[model samples]
Target: MRPMLNIAIRIIRNIGNIIIKNYEIQNINSDYNEYNINLFTKKINKNLNNMITKVIYNIYTKNITFLCKKKFFIFKYKKTIWIINPLDGVMNFFKKLPHFSISIAICIKGKTEISLVYDPLKNDLFTAIRGQNAQLNGYKLRCDKYFQKKNLLFALNTSYIFFTKKKNVNLINLFVENLISLRISGSISLDLAYLAANKIDCYLNNNVQNFNYLLAGELIIKESGGLITDFIGNCNYKNSTNILAGNADIIKLVISKIK
Candidate 1:
């Protein structure tokens, strides 16, 4: 497992380098037009997937399977499953906002074993190996300490509003009126990582179709002493994208209101 984790770290760094290089070059030749931006994303996603597939297949052989979004592949061999999202927050990155990240999660035998969320721009790496706890760069990470509910920073994402759970609509409205500070950032993966790092205390996102983006952050939250549950407080978060995450106390409060 340690060897696999090391390999994953190496792969993530390699991907980051490519992302940084491309981002800088895009700036020099930056185009805010819709058509060019779409083309740029398509080209980078293809290249990154090729690199990841080559690296994983060469080392792990046929035993590794992938569940990558934007690009999907499933092999007969299924001992190790890799959920890789080459770039999270595509909008932010292309728009010159430095808030996107690259995340990878490895699930072997039906359980997540390792997770890594790397912020290429800042060179910040958030990682966790099951039961060993979570870390940022090398220091351990934990959710923020309990505080007055209003003071807790909230990372609320509503981009996929169309997919919103009708029942939880009240919860969203409630938070806006109740919570002291709220942030509607574009990146869900980074929001989850920030929750685990104590930078944000509560994160609620609705209707995000990319499960690839949630894989690593879900494990990161658990390993860092945070809880993740659906809007109704059920553990079946994987089946749906309506997630409510934070420390136990905050989650309980949110759920009480939702219920």
Candidate 2:
């Protein structure tokens, strides 16, 4: 586990350097090289997948399956499954918003065993192992259980607004009106990570199509004493599941407002 952590740190640091350097260049030629950001992201994604494959192979002799954005590689034995999101917030990356991250999780028979999410710009690494407390950097983290409407901060991902029903939008608006504030960050992984660290008290996502997006943060929040469930408060992971994550009391507050 230590070796894996070391490798992950190294990988993210290298990738962060690449992104920062490219972003500097993009700023100088923003008008002319708008499309270059996409190319840069593609290069980074390719390098990340290749590097992870080599690193994992060297660490374990057992067959492993690797899943990432638009690419899935399967090795024969499948004792472990590695799920990764090399660049989580590509849109933010292209916009040079500094809100993107790298997410990685190891699952055994569909249950996550280890999870990691790295924010390159902030150098924040959130990690959790099943049955162990979640950590930011090296310090243990736990969610805040207090549910105060006057002081609560809710992180929301409103990307699903186009597809969401009117009732759902009304429910979201209810939260907006009642909570102290509502934040919409484009990165779902970071939103969940922030929730686990108590930087935000709650997170709601209506369009999490892939488990890869939430897998790492899910474990982190859970190990940090946060509760995550579908819109109706069921602990099921599926493509259609709308994510609601926070401490137990906040989760109940969110569930109660869903119409």
Candidate 3:
């Protein structure tokens, strides 16, 4: 394992602890409403970003900058980029469902070199380094979810599924009509993590702009012998508005059926 990856693991675990602790505290409060849920999640996001920046800068201050949204914010320097999503699956978290995670991607020179998605609730840590295979809790992953399965487990955000029916969302409609089995998990990181861990066969994401989730996903999926591509079999997913990801065989079958 690379030394930088070691540091990233520590950071992930540290943040995971914070999430679990806060979640437990919030669970004890029965006055859970939409307003308080939003407030709690937002506050947690801000704290995570601050802690991540502080820790990374304390060591690699001169070599790292953060990629937030569509632009990079260079905090006094630049070389490597870190996209850290403080939290994913806000709805699940609010409903007290244990499906959220903290995702981090380290990109160097426009390429993802290291990735991690840690489920604080389950303590399942998925990680990958460039050129090395992905791992889940120390076991190597290989994108072979179907080896012991009977169905083609396709995953995406549930809200998109609802939008497809109500609003006729074309971006998401392109998938629901053509895919096999459906599994909706709100967190994008978990969708990718599930694919790597053999829990899902494919994941179609409508939004590709979130490097915070997708970049980290890209590294771990590829490392696990999976691939992330646009709807038409193109490898350049970052430039596209959406992405279709799975192992090569599933990807080929999916594209063949899309209009």
On residues 1-259, what C-alpha lDDT tens digit does candidate 3 reach at each position? 4988998899899889888878787762477777887678666767767877788888775755455552222222455766667678766777778889888787777778888999998899999999988999999998873442235678875545435454335534545554457777888888998898778888886655555567787789999988889878888777787788898888877676564
lDDT digits (tens) for residues 1-259 of candidate 1: 7888888899889889988988887862355777887788777877787887788778867555465445333222456777767778777888778888888888878888899999999999999999999999999998765757566788887565623658766676667677557787877778999999989988987766667678889889999999988878888887886888999888888888788
Error of 2 at 239 (Å): 6.4
Q: What is the Cα-based lDDT of residue 141 in candidate 2?
A: 96
- What C-alpha lDDT does candidate 1 achieve relative to the native structure? 0.80
lDDT of the structure predicted as candidate 3: 0.75
Q: TM-scores of the models, in the given order? A: 0.88, 0.86, 0.83
The TM-score that candidate 3 achieves is 0.83
lDDT of each: 0.80, 0.75, 0.75
Top-scoring candidate (TM-score):
1
**lDDT score of residue 21 within candidate 3:** 79
User: In terms of TM-score, which candidate is stronger, 2 or 3?
Assistant: 2
Per-residue lDDT tens digits for candidate 2, residues 79-152, read: 56667676677777777787888777777777888888888888899999889889999999989877777777
Q: Pick the candidate with the highest lDDT.
A: 1
Rank by TM-score, descending? 1, 2, 3
Count of clashes, each model: 0, 0, 0
